[model samples]
Target: MTEPTRVLIVGGGYVGMYAALRLQRELRRHEARITLVDADSYMTYQPFLPEAAAGNVEPRHVVVSLRRVLDRCRILNGWVVGVDPVARTVDLRPHGGPGRVLEYDILILAPGSVSRTLPIPGLAECGIGFKNLEEAIHLRNHVLGQLDLADSTTDDATRARALTFVFVGAGFAGVEALAELEDMAHDACAYYPTIEPGQMRWILVEATDRILPEVGPEMGRWTLEQLRGRGVDVRIRTRLLSAVGGRVVLDDGTEYDTDTLVWTAGVRPHPLVRATGLPLDAAGRLKATAELTVEGARDVFTAGDCAAVPDLTRPGETCAPNAQNAVRQARTLADNVVATLRGGELRPYRHAYAGSVAGLGLHQGVAQIYGHKLHGMPAWFMHRTYHLSRVPTLNKKVRILIDWTLALLFRREIVSLGQLSDPRKEFERAARADREGRAEEPVLR
Candidate 1:
């Protein structure tokens, strides 16, 4: 009997999950066994994360259960520490333990990128990233909590710090997050008589000359204009020199004290790619051909932000790290994998960007689809139409539509559950009381 083709997929992200789903559908039964291992059990719909942060969307809705999605494939929740291409074995550290190895006949590396952080002073301790669901929830709570703090505080310095929001990087993530949260905060101020929208400072700092480089320069300028009109301080060609002592110092000699500093500068490919000893591009992305196969690795394939897929559509450019490329590459990569197994010809991936869409909170947005530029309600409609079509399952799509519909009739809930992050705080206090031999008693301060 011929040995079964064991396909090992690292990461259950956009590329891995979609590719595996397509493979399970396309491949014949008993021919190949798929094993998908990811650090997390659920796949996060990253596009909705800004809405999640702004409390416009539920945090749970943004993450699709991987076990439910990849029912046929073996799912292992573990961190992939290293890969041995020569031995066809993957090293995995299951949650919080020592490493173990799993052998495979074929390897599909879709280990997604992490938050690209800089060595700015105090950033490791003070800064928060907008990558995961936890961060989104924390951000929402943090923002709302700041309003509470500002409302209670009589000190002008404290109130100013609480209201000051600084976002580094004016890409899709940063811009959307800033815009959405600003809208949420502005709306929240209506409930607080002491809090004023004019007191809130929303600052965006971009290192590049233009924001939203994925969108055309014209759209980028328009976005800047919209943000400026909303009273957002847009700083271009500026670098965050230091965030030390919660004091944001720009390279241009401007300094400001802020309680919240959001870092969405960008993302780099997963560092695990380097351990494979595979050839990498200048940016350290796994060097992959237009067909999504890793160079010189016959049984290995890679795609998404982690892989430097050659862009056949653009003569000399590698595919940009965006959801558009990731999802499209997954489809092509799946086809390629199926072709490799079933003795069919593989096709090269070549697709021009469809265009870009961005929401400036609620009914305000900007979009450029198929060469047609749209702004205001048209852009907002396109933004909803495009993302609504792409947000995975029908159930989720309907739920999101319902949420939007309800939002039109009802007001957005700005309440924060800050205790979610510290549920054990009360328990810790009780434990401390027990240790001190002080029975739980109500004391009037």
Candidate 2:
């Protein structure tokens, strides 16, 4: 009996998860062995992150557990350190364990991107990214905690500082996060007699001239107007000079002190791609043909945000890094992988640009679809409808829909669980006191 070929997939994101799921159905159990490796065991639905932060959707429902969905495939929870295409081997660094190398007959590279950041002083220490589920949850808690601090404080300066929220970059992530959080905080302010919506300051700073460039210029202009009308400080063509000491200083000579800073400038390809010895484009993404096969690398397939797949529909431009493209590309990449394995002809991937949608806040959104522009409730509905269709799995889709249904009938929950960030702080402190042979009294503020 001959051993079945092994198919190894790195990164449990949309591309990796979808590709593996498709391959499992195409290849019989005895035909091949499939495996997926990722730092986390779940794939985050990034499009719904803003809603999660706003408490419209539960954070747990925003992630699809790879283990639960990819039952037949081996799920290895770890970081991929390196890959050698020539040797057909990958080096994986597991958490708190020695590294090990695994050999595979075919490899699928889909390690998604990380938050692209700039070298502004104090950013590394204070700035928070909005890419993952943890960050979304933390940002929700941090924002609500700030409201509590402001309400409890009598000092004008302290209250003002706590009420000021600054978001850098005006792309979908930055804009939607800022919008949803602002909306949630504003609604919660009704409960605090001392805090008012007018007291809070929401500032959006963009280096580019406009925000939401995914939408057309006309819709972008409309979005700018809508945001400014809501008392948001929309600053365009401005650069963040320094965030040192919580004092945000911009290149335009505007400086202010704020506790919250969200950096969502953009994203580059995963740095792991560079270490893989794979052919990379100028932007450091894996270079691949339209068929999703890595250029000059044998038996290697690539897709998603990590690969620079030429856009056949738009001539010179590569496919934009979004959930729509990632999910679609995965199916094509998966079919091509199976084709390669079975000695069948591979299919080239090509899809037309499907337009963009963004949720500004609850019941507020903007969308540009196939040259038609929509705003307000219609656009918001379109945003939800589109994402609900793409979020993966019938169970998750139903869960999210139920969440939306419940949200319509009840007020948004405003509770903040700030202690999640340091769940063991109290235990560690008590243990330290025991070691000192003293009974520590609970410290009262």
Candidate 3:
């Protein structure tokens, strides 16, 4: 009897989950024992996160439960702390605890990226990021809560600060999030008697010369026009020098005191890659060939944001870190793994850049598909079409569609469950009361 081949995959993002799914489909029964380790139990559909924050989609729908999806693969809800490729072992820290080591025959490194934050003062304390489901829900509640605070406050400065929203980074994540949330906030104004559309400000600061660089220069210009037309203060070539003391100081010497600061500048590879002791590219990504195999490491594969896979289509450059590339790479990576296991020829990954789409609030957007430009309703429709087709799983697609359908027939829900984020606050208060020699007040329902 032969020992079962142990295959371990790190991370539960698009790359890891999709690769595992394909692996399960391709491999023969009992041929491989697959174990997937991730810090999160759910795979976040990152593109829908903006809509989740805007109440256009349910928060739960944005994340697919890995346990349900990857039932065939043994799932370990933990983070990969280190990898020993020479010894074929991995160290895992389950939710920031002490480590556990596991041995494997094949290792797939797809730990994915984290929020690429800068050392901007007060940002760590005051600023919020829009990368995951928790951040999305927190942002939604915080935005709605700001409206509530602004409506009740009599002071002009406090109301202004609360109403002022600043989003730094003009990439897809930052731009889309700002656009959707701004639209939602504007629609929410009707519910607040004291608030007006003009009173609320949506400021977008980009360090680059333009926004939506993925959409090309022409469409990027059009996007700027549309945003400015809708009263969005889009500032380009502006660096956020310091956000200390809740005061945002720009490189252009402009200053603003705002309560909300969303940092979506970009993302960097996960820190675990450093501990892996693998050869990395100049950008710190694991250097990978077109077939998605790590250089100088046999039986080790990497893809998605963590691997710098060569772009055969672009010659000198590597594939960009986007969902389109990630999905395609995952499929190719899985196939390559199967090929290596079964002694088949591996195929190189090469794909052309499909056109780009951007939604600027409701019923308005800009899309450039295969040299054709679209705007307004057509572009908004395209945005929905492209995303719905890409969002993975028929069940989630149906749920998202239902959410949108319901939105057309009903008003958007503005309720906030802020307490969910800090469930221990009530317990802390109760403990304080007990310390003060007062009987617990029946634990307020």
Instruction: Tell me the lDDT of candidate 2.
Output: 0.92
What's the CA error at residue 177 for candidate 1, in Å?
Answer: 0.4
For 299-415, candidate 1 gives per-residue lDDT tens digits of 899999999998887788999888888999999999998888888888999998899998888788888888888878888788878888998888788888888888888899988
- Where does candidate 2 clash, by residue pair? none
lDDT of model 1 at position 444? 14
**TM-score result, candidate 2:** 0.97
Least accurate 10 contiguous residues by lDDT in model 2: 436-445
My TM-score estimates for the predictions, one after another, are: 0.97, 0.97, 0.96
lDDT of 3: 0.89
Candidate 2 local lDDT, 271-322, one digit each (tens): 9999988889898999989999999975999999999999999999898888
Q: How many clashing pairs per prediction, in order? A: 0, 0, 0
Candidate 1 stretches with Cα past 4 Å from truth are 438-445
| lDDT for residue 370 in candidate 1, whole number 0-100 | 88
> Weakest 10 consecutive residues, lDDT, candidate 3?
436-445
| Candidate 3 lDDT over residue span 1-445, tens digit each | 7777898999899999999999999898667899999988989998888899999888888788888988799999877778999999998888766789999988899999989998888889888888898998988988888998899889999899989899999999899999999999999999999999888889999999999988889889989998898899999999898888789888988888888899999999988898998999988999998999899987899999999999998899999988889989999999998888888999999989888888877898888898898888999999999999887789999999999999999989888677777889788878888899887664321
Clashing pairs in 1: none
Deviating ranges (above 4 Å) for candidate 3: 96-98, 437-445
